[model samples]
Every structure is written in C-alpha cells, then in structure tokens.
Target chain A: MRRTSPISVYLSLLTALLCQLFPWVGQGVILRPDFMLVVILYWLLRSPNLCNVGTAWFAGLLVDLATGSLLGQHALTFSVTAFVALTYQRRLVLFNTWQLLAYVFALLMIERVLILLLKLFEGNENPGFMYFWPVITGLLLWQIMILLFGSLTRPKTN
Target chain B: MLKGVHQKLEPQQSPAFFVRGPSPFSRMVFFCALSVSIMAADARFNYLSQVRQGFIAALHPLEVLANAPSEWTRDTKKYFSEHNRLVQENYALKEQAFEQQIKLQRFNTIEAENTHLRTLLNGNIPIQPKAILGEISHMGRDPFTHTVVVNRGSQHNIKAGQAVVDSKGVIGQVTRVYPFTSEVTLITDKELSIPIQIERNQLRAIAFGEGNNTLDIPYLPTNVDIKVGDKLVTSGIDGVYPSGLAVAIVTKIQQNPESPFAKIVSTPVADVSNHLQLLLLALPDYKEDELSKVAPIETTATKKELSNKNTALIKNKAKANAPH
Candidate 1:
C-alpha cells in the first residue's frame, strides 16, 4: 500500500474547494461536478485512518458556507455518505478496478439523492433530471483521482 | 510439561490493520444530529447570519483567487477586440445619450410642474432614492435559489432589503450583505413578491415569483381587466421600490370555469443573464418609522405616541419648507 501524507490530503481538499468556488456561467453551472465531495470520498476510501467522517462533515460545512445555502444541509448529507462509504470499506481491498468504480458511482448517487430530498424539504421547486448531471461529472473526476493518486486496489502478481 | 503448555497457550494482543478512532455509525449519528440542529437554528432563528457574514468575509480572498482566471480571460478578450466594433458602439451610445437628454429635459419640466401641483394641494412630495452601481460577481452557487452575488457589500454601505435594477427594469433585491459582496435574490425567486400596477389600466395587485422564471398574480378575478400585453410597474406603496419602474409583462393567463381567480403569469423584463451591471437603490430613510407604525397595535398609548411623533415631524418639515 502506498503511504498517504495528511498534508497532501488536506492540500487536495483545499484545491477542490477552490474549484467549487469557480464562477460557472450559463449551462456550466448546471453541469459542474461536486468537487469537494468527490475529493473527500477519494481520501476517505484510500486512507480511512487519516480522513474520517469528521473531515467530511467539516468539508460539507465549508461548502454550505461557500454556496450560501441553508447551513448544515450539505453537512448532514456528507456525513451520511461518509458513513455509508466506511461501512463497506474493509471489503473494498478484495474488489477490482471495475467494482471499485461501481462502488464510487453508487456513493455519488446516494449523496445526490440525499441533497435532492433536503432541497425538496426546504420548499424548493423540483430542479428536474439535469440535477443529476453532477453525478456523471463526479464519476469522471473519480477516474482522474485514481489516475493521479494510484488506485485503491492492490497490484496483481503472477 | 503441563505448566509449559499452559504458558504457551496464553492469548496475545495483536495490532489491528485499521485504526479508526470511532465507529462509523456513531460518528454518523453524532454529525447528523449536529447538522440537524444547525439547520433548525438557521432556518427558525436569526443567530447564524453573523456567522455566515464572518465566514464569507474570511473566504473573500480565496474567492477572488478563484475568479482571477476568468477575469484575465475577459480582459484579454477586451484588449483584442476590433477597433471598428468599439467605434461603432461608441457612436451608437452617443446617439442614444442625445435622444435620452432630450427626453430628460421634458421629464424635468413635468417633474417640476408635478411638485408644484403637489405643494399647492398639500400632498407629500415623493422622494428620489439614491443608487450605487454594482457589478455581478457571479450567479449564486446554489441552483435551487434564484440569486446573484454583487460586488458591493456592507463595506460599500449596501444594506439588506435594498432594491436592485438594471438599465431595462427591476432585477431583484439585496437579501444578504457580506463584507465585500452581497447576494441579490432575483425577482423570480419563489420567496420574493413585488407590489405592481397594471400600466395600461392602473389596476393594482401583488405579483409573486413562481420559481420557474415567471411571476404569478393570484387572486385577480377572471373578469379583471388585464390583457396578454399589459405591463406591470412598481406601485411604490411598499416604499422599497420606486414608483413606475417596469417590472414584467403579462404573458399567459389561464382561467377555469370552476375557479373564480385567474392564473396569471408574466416574464420579468430585466434578465440577469443578459447584463452584469446593476444599480442597488438605497432603502428609504423613513422605512423604520413606517414599519414601527405598521407594527401590530400592542398598546393604544404607544400607537398614539408614534402617530403624534410622526405628525410632529411632518409639521416641522412643512413649516421649514413653507416659502420663507
């Protein structure tokens, strides 16, 4: 297993926050990925000991402050998503690349649905199916994360 | 031999592979409760606005850094624009300004005449609101809320509840003020409503945002004298918006035989997507006094006291202005 430093983990999360702050205009706003969520999930899966549910909760709080939504909305959803990811974390070592990708995809979808329910509960209008566009973009970001910082699975030996 | 065997069979503690501090379930429950309480406090009370303002102020530097790349690109594009296009725009703007100046002269005469007539009739003269120019920093991050962030903020003397407008017409209102930036809730947001009058017939009504980029005027009877092309302008009774600013144009009206109220929807005239510069009009100075008077009649003595104070101030102003 590759060793991950705490500094690198935090630096990457800060970069993700910056990306979230980018001024997306027109259709770009609709398609922008959940950057901080994807990065937090990546670290949570690869090094659960270093980054935990508390980290995810804090990151979600920052997102809430940045987005100027009702406070704690993202925090609630993010902590729940982190818990779900950690529940099956031990079994992940035996999974292959494809299985890992599917797992991450499911995690992303769960987060999206939770946020949708929260928004609906807050009396917002249904944003339609285009709201799910971020899940696809977040999946692509996951692949990029794997490419940059090695995969979660161990290497094969003959 | 039995003693040796027993010693060897003693259990040993081994280091675990995963060293997570807390169980995931417990952590989830803890954070969930924390966040739910936060949401409740934020939604039901006014305690968190100060926290939000301080956080945004601290995050201002990072936001500017994130916006730098886009600003650079726009500047480069502006530098590389064709000179011919600039000249043409300048010429068109100059001609427009000349036409507006002529209209302004006529307006000045009419305004003076109206003020003279109001004074003769002992009516209160309307106040002209001051406005500050602001640029749209970005569309709001939350897609669920129809809002835009403006560059001006509390540091620039921007206050919440100020009306916003563009060159074309009314745009939105300032709902939250940070240190260097403010959030403007667009008129189409479901939470905002504006008092409006039909420009063609002078019939007054309140228009609410439908959350789908349309304004709804509910409770207007089906027999009301409104048309598809009727214009809606600010009524100015609320004191937030100036009177006669264009707001929206009636687009679609649906009526059912069983229902008495008409389903009226209109599209806003000022589109935030089309422009980046807008004006934030200052809140009226007497708004506080007006609100105090409108407060529920808790005590008859206090209500009478407030009315007396208001009349005294008005009389003092009238005496000061009486052609001395």
Candidate 2:
C-alpha cells in the first residue's frame, strides 16, 4: 500500500478547506475552483483506506454549511464523487498521470452538473457558460496539489 | 476457529487488496440517503438551522484564518498608497463633510416639523432605524448567487431579515446571521424581491431580481404612466426596508402588441463592486405583523397582474414612459 499518515491526510484536507473559504468576489468568484472537492478527490483516490466516502461526505457537508445553499447539496455531490474515485482506485495504481488528470476532470464535471441540475430544480435561472469555469480551474488546482503532496504514482521517465 | 470463520468470509470479500469495507455503491447509497433526508429537513423545516449555526460558528476561526491574507494585502496597499492621492482624498472628504453638515442642519428642523405634522394626523411615529456599519469580509463562494459575507452578525446584535443599504441605495437583505458574519443577498439575485414606489408618483410595485445584475419590474398594464429617469424607492409596505430609500432607475421598457404585460428593467442605484462599507438597517420591530397584513392584498385585477416574477418590471416601464 502507498504510504500516507492519517494526520497528514486530514491536514491537507484542512488546507483545501481554507482555500475554499477564501473570500472571492466579482469575477474571481467565477474562477474559484472546487478546492475542497479536488483535494478530497485526490485523497479519496490515493488512500481510500484512510479517507473513504464517509470522509468526503462529511467534507461536503462542511461546504454545504459554508455556502449556505441547500444543506445536503454539496454532501450529495461529494459523496458521489468519492464513490466514483473509489470505483477506479485500484485501476489508478496502474494508470499514468495523464490518465489520472482525465479522471479528476471527469469527477469535477460530475460535481458541476450535479449542482447545476439542483439549482435548476430549485427554480434558479440557468447561469450561462461561465458556470463550468470552476471545473477547469479545479483540474489546475489538482495538478498543484499533486505537485505539493507528491503524485499518486512516480513521475514518468523522460 | 476465528481464522476459519474469517477465511470463509474473506474469500467472498477478497476481490483485491484494500477492499476491506462495504462496496462503493452501498456506501454511496447510504450517504445519498443521509443527504437527501438532511436536505428535506433543512428546506421543508427549520430543525437544522441551529445545527447549521453551530457548525458555522465552529468554522469561524478558519474563516478568519482564510481572511487574514486579504486583510494584510488591503492594509499594505493602503499604507503604501501615494501621498498625493491620500491628500487629494482627504481634501475631497473634508469638502463633502462641510456640505453634508449644512444638509444635516436643515434636515434636523425638517424632521422635527415632519414629526409634528405626523402627530397631528395621528400617524404612527416612524423610528429612525439603528444601523450596524460593516465591512464586506468577502464575496460569496457561490457564483450562481449574489451574496456577501460582512464582518457583523448575531454577536454584534445584527439579526437576519435586516435591510442592507450602501451609500447609493438598497443593496440587499441579510439572510443568514452567524456569530461573526452575516450573508447579504443582493436585490439583483433571483431569490430576493423588494417593494418599491415611484419617487415622482408613488405608484407602488414590487421589484424582482433578474438573476443577472439587473432588476425587473413586472405587472403594470401596457399604458401605465411611467417614464425613463423615474426613481424607484422602497414603499415601506414590507416593513423590512424603510420607505423612501432610493432603489433604482428605469433603464429599459418593452411593450409588445401581442403580450398583455409590458416588460421593464432597472439598474439598482447601489454600486456594490466599488463600495465595501454598507449599512444593515435593523429589521423594524413591527415587521412580522406588518408582513402578515400585506400578504392578502391581491384584491384587484392589478394585483393579479402583479404576481409575475418581475412586477417591478411593469412599474419601471410605467415610470420610464411617464412625464417627469
């Protein structure tokens, strides 16, 4: 099994929480990625034995409480993302970095779609294309986190 | 014996290493159910509000930690601002203070005279609302909604349901109050609405947020007497916002021959992007009863037409088409 202490995992999640809580106003709000989700998805994929679906659900609940949207909204999405990540966790050991990035991008897209569907159901007007900016930003954030924490797999040889 | 029982179960469960717990699908099912019920309890009821408040309160330290960098940057920027610019700003502010002092002197007498006239008419005296001055700590994390977290909340006696106004006009309402902060939902958000009157004619209407940065006024007839440049202000009917605060100005009006109602839009007077300081007008003492009373006033054909999401649109169109 890959080496990761539980304390470090929790600490990394806390760092993501702070980024998520950082006050973004005006156009910056549109660009703010799902920091907590990207981080949680990272840990979920890398160390599901330590940080499982329950942890992702709880992290998502914190986001819901923070955003002051419908209380369960983020919780639902985060749990589902965690599940998706877990389903592919075994295969992830063999997959290269590019394949991993693609997988993370797909996970973020699922989250955005979940939120959009929920918002539309709640009678909110459809926000236009700028809505998906967070997914792209999230992928970039995932890369940054990977660099900081070291990758799920070894860096490929030149 | 234990190893034999474990061996019998382990073979069925052992698909791969690290697969010790329940399947991901089962976990997903468990969590999704938990979340759905939580959502139902939250939206359909108020049981979780206190729970929510407690969790947010616990999160307050982390919020401050997150906010610290922005605070430092803002302060350093202020400290390093050019001397010439500071002088210019100070000079301009002094001039404005002098002008405002003159207005204040006149306003004091006008207010006294107005009170005397109101007493004579046996009208209820309107109390000047107490205001809590707050700085915008941060804009909301959600892009789909227009909300801001200010640095004042329940600990400071700031309550939910207060009317927040910036210097230019009404900005929004305080929807959530935490220990150290509150969320103000701007009037241009789709979920918020404010009752307004034409400053020139006092025609009452409700303004709805268009979700974009614009406000829509719906529900007036095709030939309502409103014109461009007409100012919309709070009508005071809702009791949440005090009457007569400037709201917006009619910006666009579309009256189609086929449609029964005219479409109107207005730009809010408040400039949220530029200004950070704002006033959270305390929710009036009598708001609950007043709101209940106003609920049943759909008495006329006009009231039926006023039910559109943007009744403010109609009011704006009328104001735009009217003679000033």
Candidate 3:
C-alpha cells in the first residue's frame, strides 16, 4: 500500500473549514453547501489511514463550535457519518461513479435527519422544505471534490 | 487486463492484511454508541458546557483567519469611496450631532428627575449592565437555528446569557461564549421567549419566536385592544432584558371566531441582518422575587373583574401550563 503524508490532508481540511466560515448573506445562505462535510468525506474515502472516524468527529466539533448549535449535536452526527463512510471505503473501489454519489447522498441525508431529530426533541419548530437544501448542495460539492482532488479509487492513466 | 490481475494478486497473499485491527462493524457500533451517549449527556444535562467552552476558545484563531478577508474588503471599500458621497455623509452626520446635542441637555435633566422619583418611591434602581461592543463575525452556518457569532467572547468579558441589542431595539441574547468569540441567538429563534408589553394598551404578554422572524403572543383574547403597527417593548420582568427597550412592531393580527385567542405576529425592530455593531449586556443577577413580580404587574390593567390582579393570576397560571 502506498503511504500518503498527513500534512496535505490537514491543510485541505483547514481550507474547507475556512470555506465553511465564508460570509454568506440573504438567500444564498440557505443554499450554501456543507463544505467541511464534503472535505471530511473526501479524506475519509481517499486516506482512511490518515483521516479516521476520530478526525471526522473533531471536525464536526469545530463546526458545532462555529455554528453554535448544541455542543455535541453535529459531532455526534458527523462521527457516525464518518464511521458509515469508512465501513464502505474498501468496497467503494468496486463501485462506479454513480454508486459513489449515491453512497455519499445517503451519508449526508443521515446527518440531516439526525440533526432534525435533535432539533425537534429540543422543541424547535419544523424548518419545512428548506432544511433539505444543503444535502442537494453538498452533493453538488462532492462532484467538485472528486474532479479537483482526484477520485478515491486507483488513479487513471492513458 | 490479464497481466494487471496477476500483479494485483501478490498483495493478497501477504499476512499483513489480517492485522488491520478490529472489524469496521464493531468499531462502528462502539463509536456510534459513544457519540449517542455524549449527545444525550449534552442535551439532557449540563455536563459538557465547559468542554464546549474550551474547544471554542481554542478554535478562535482559526475563526479570525477565516474572517480576515471580509474585514479587509470592508476596510478597502471605505478607502476608495467617492468624495462627493463622503461630503454629503459628513454634512448629514454634523446636523444629526447638533440635533442630538440639544436633546441630550433635556435628557440629562429628565434622567436625574426620574432617578430621584424612583428613590422616593422606594423602587429598586435599575442596574446598568456593562456592555461589550462586538461585530458580527458571520451569520450562523446552520440555517435551522437563528444565531450570529460575534468577534468578542469571554476574552472581552462577554458571557453566555447576556442580552444583545442594536441601536433600534433588542436583537438577541448571547448563548455561548468562547475565548475570543461568542454566539448570539436572535429573538426570532424558537428557544427564545421575551416578556413584552403592548405600547397602545399596556397589555403585558410573553412573546415567543414562531421561527419565521416573527413573534407570537399567544393566549390573548380575540377582542383584545391591539392593532397593526402597535409597538412592543420588553417588560423586563425576566430580569434579563431591561424594561422598556423596544422589541418588535406589530405586523399582522388575525382573529379566528373558531379559536378563543387572537393570532398576533410582530417583526423584530432590530435590524440584525444589516448591522455589525451590537452591545452584549452583562448577565443579570437572577432574583426569585423578580419572577413573582410578573403576576402583580399584569393586574395593573383595570377592567374591574379584569383588574391587573386577575391578569397577574392569569399570567401565573399560564406560566405554569406554558410548554417552554
């Protein structure tokens, strides 16, 4: 197995965190992609040895801090997402692009549903249709991650 | 394809693959359980607030790094502004200052008289909360909750539970304080509730966020003397927000013959979306007697049988049954 340096993974995660922190105003904020989640998913798929469930859990904690949601809400959902993603990491090699996208779609949907349940239990009013907008935007961002950083599977050569 | 398959088969024979530690299934189950318990401990109890505060304090530098570009853009935009606009703005500001100076003279005398009157009445002098001025670092990342992170936090003596206000009115309350940043949950948030009085009739009611940038004053009768454009201000019975600060302006009132109560909606007067500078008022000293005072004040309105005393009992009963 080829070994990858840990520094690049961390740098990429930092960049993604900054992107998540970028100022968004008005309607654009509703459709803003979950940048940190997409990046953590990428690293979990690409280098499981370097970025594990613990790393994803830490990233979610940062988001919880940044978003100021309940302290452990995102951390709980994200760690579970990372664990789910890593479970299928090896089998992902046999899946095609459509299958990979579908898998990521499910992971993001789980995170949303988990957060929704938490919010409801905490007595929040239902957010309605707009709550799911991020999952669609995050899926679009996943494609960009694959295009720029290369896929999780073997590199293609002519 | 045949040659590539033969080459890839060699790694499968290696014994090192067997030593990849615990199966992913057990690890997944273990970690999932751990996270679930942590979530429960956080939500149902107060076990993790300190841990969260420390983590946020540590994350402050990264937040500033993220905020630098926006700060730079705001500064540069100021530097390259048109001279004509600047002159007009300067003139407007000078006129405003002169007008405000005249008002300040009258205000000083009125304030002194008001203090003297309160002393004679044996009323407790309202404590002036120390405020920390902070800029909105960003709107909340989660669209589900209405919150804003300010650049000032515990480092600036800002604490959770402090009231936040802009020039126009009450905006929100500080819910979380990190080292160099804090989070303000706006009055429009579902978890926030404010005690307010109708400026027209002085009918005091509690306003709760309906989650659409509007507040709901539930349980008031349909025949209540409230109209559109009525002003609502903090009643300050909660001892958190100071009394008589503007809160919202009535936008719509719906009376349903089928229901016992009128549906009133008001939009917050504070322009939380457009402004950066907000004052975080210090957390108040919680006094049990202040809560008890909520009921007595409700009786101040006189309808004979609907005397302020009965109104107070209604409030106390409502507070007992309320789902907050």
What TM-score, to 2 decimal places, does chain A of model 1 have? 0.98
lDDT of 1 at B4: 89
lDDT of 1 by residue, B23-89 (tens): 9999999999999999988877656888889999999999999999999998899999999999999
Q: Write the per-residue lDDT of candidate 3 for residues A1-158, one digit (tens) a residue.
A: 55657887888888888877777767778888778888999988887867777777878877876676666677778888888898788898788788888999999999889889888887777888888898999999998888877776655558
Every model's TM-score: 0.90, 0.88, 0.84
Error of 2 at B165 (Å): 1.1
TM-score rank order: 1, 2, 3
lDDT of 2 at B322: 100
Identify the runs in model 3 with alpha carbons over 4 angstroms from their true place: A1-3, A154-158, B1-14, B283-324
**Interface RMSD for all numbered candidates:** 0.6, 1.0, 2.0
Q: On residues A1-158, what C-alpha lDDT tens digit does candidate 1 reach at each position?
A: 77999998999998999999999988988999999999999999999988899999999999999999999999999999999999888898899999988999999999999999999998888899999999999999999998988888878879
Each candidate: what lDDT?
0.89, 0.84, 0.79
Q: Tens-digit lDDT track for model 2 on B214-252?
A: 998888887887788889999987667899999999988
> Which has the greatest lDDT?
1
Worst 10 residues of 2 chain B by lDDT: B294-303
The residue-by-residue lDDT of candidate 3 on B184-218, one tens digit each, is 88889876788899887788999988778899999
Scored on chain A only, each candidate's TM-score is: 0.98, 0.94, 0.92
What stretches of model 1 exceed 4 Å from their correct place?
Answer: B1-17, B288-324
